[model samples]
Target: MLTVAHSVPKTPEHEETIHKAQYNVARAYFMGFGAPSSEDDGRRWLDRAAADGTRRGSVKAQTMLAMLFARRDTLDLEKSFHWHSEATGNGSLESQGALGVMYLYGLGVRRDLVAARLCLTQAARRGNIYATGQLALFYYRFRFYQHAVRFGTHLARFEAADVAELARQSECLPGYVRRGLATGCYVLSRCQLLGQGGLAADGERGRLLGGRAAELDAATADRLQRLFVNGPWSCASYPDLGVEV
Candidate 1:
């Protein structure tokens, strides 16, 4: 008696193809790109992709899962943290940034500034602009003036015209990028005004940078002004000033 298998057996050679297909299927279901939106079905396919032995889709699938679980309506911080940690272990840059934020804010794990700085620095070095801004702010918060200025100056390199252009295309950019840019500009401006870092005092440049920060993210600029006085690093010390597009 010959028994037929229901489906083809999975092999290492087929892993990449299967992972890609699974990811596409998940996207279609999740975003209604070609199929009706169904988070449940999307998650199922994503899980399969994430489980691929080759680890090709490990970062992508886990990152998406972490983000999906972090949504307000489906908020599951622990699950989000788990997926982020897994993706980070698999060398996902975005996940590294996310874990930095999680550690910074203690989203699903204990607050740890050292870990947050390490994660943010790793991502920022790889050109994650948002992480660059966050790392600047992190250093500023803890009174590491030199380090903060280093990153802030990197972000404040934008020209006035460039800032205006970014504002024009703001809708196309991610909110995090906008907020991060704003943070960098704001911190650099403050450093210029106070001469806290090793840079020469330049109130004119500080004001210009501050104006640019306001143009990009007025709310954050304003909030930081009110919250500039730094104290010990505690949960209450850092306020999450979220600005949106």
Candidate 2:
């Protein structure tokens, strides 16, 4: 039975009904609609006409249910996963990314690198910049150096990848991988500068890239600068590379 009301045409009465419906939906989702302990009760309201027949309603219900389950320390992982997965399947980019995160962390399922990669790749292909950044971090941390290089290359070529992508992913990845990527960029720049690494490594060009990195994340950049100053191989071998806060 379609218990929830459908959206009405523009009119004072219709507007009132819409407002009431919206409130009920929110209440049912957050406050449990007088059914706080029962998933079936919550589902009944969620499955009402408003959610069942409308895209927006469906998305709202799905997100709410997902969050509800996620907040429960003892929540059913399978249910949470299913709700989020359904939301993503319904064209919710946020849900898509969230699902990717779930896969990455193995929240509701077994840890699966390939599945995580697939989810992130799907979101990234859809212009989800966060997903792209996440994928970059994943590759970097996993020692997929070639993949990281390709991702960096793509960002450089497209100009769509912002510095924020690097920053966001940096929060989740190991310090070493972040440092390594910066180092790789520095090395590449040096190659361009002076005609090394299959090209001339240009000091001037290297400085430019290094300077840019420093500007983006000052701490990492400074560490990198010091490392370069000390000599690459020597820095690599040094216990701390003399990097200080």
Residue 90 lDDT, candidate 1, scale 0-100: 81
Clash-forming residue pairs, model 1:
none
Which residue segments of model 1 deviate by more than 4 Å?
1-10, 52-54, 158-173, 218-226, 229-245
Give the per-residue lDDT digits (tens) of candidate 2, residues 120-192: 7887676554455456546655556456555544543322134346445432223333443444454344345
TM-score of each: 0.77, 0.46
* Per-residue lDDT of 137 in model 1: 84
How many clashes in each structure?
Answer: 0, 15
In candidate 1, what are the lDDT values of residues 1-245, reduced to their tens digit?
Answer: 00111124377655556666777778888898877899998888888777732366645787787877777788787888888888778877767777888888887889887898899889887766667888888888778999999999898876444544543443212555667788899999988988888978889988988998898778768867766764454445444422110
**Best-fitting candidate, scored by lDDT:** 1
lDDT of 1 at 237: 49
* Candidate 2 global lDDT: 0.52
Summed over model 2, clashes come to 15
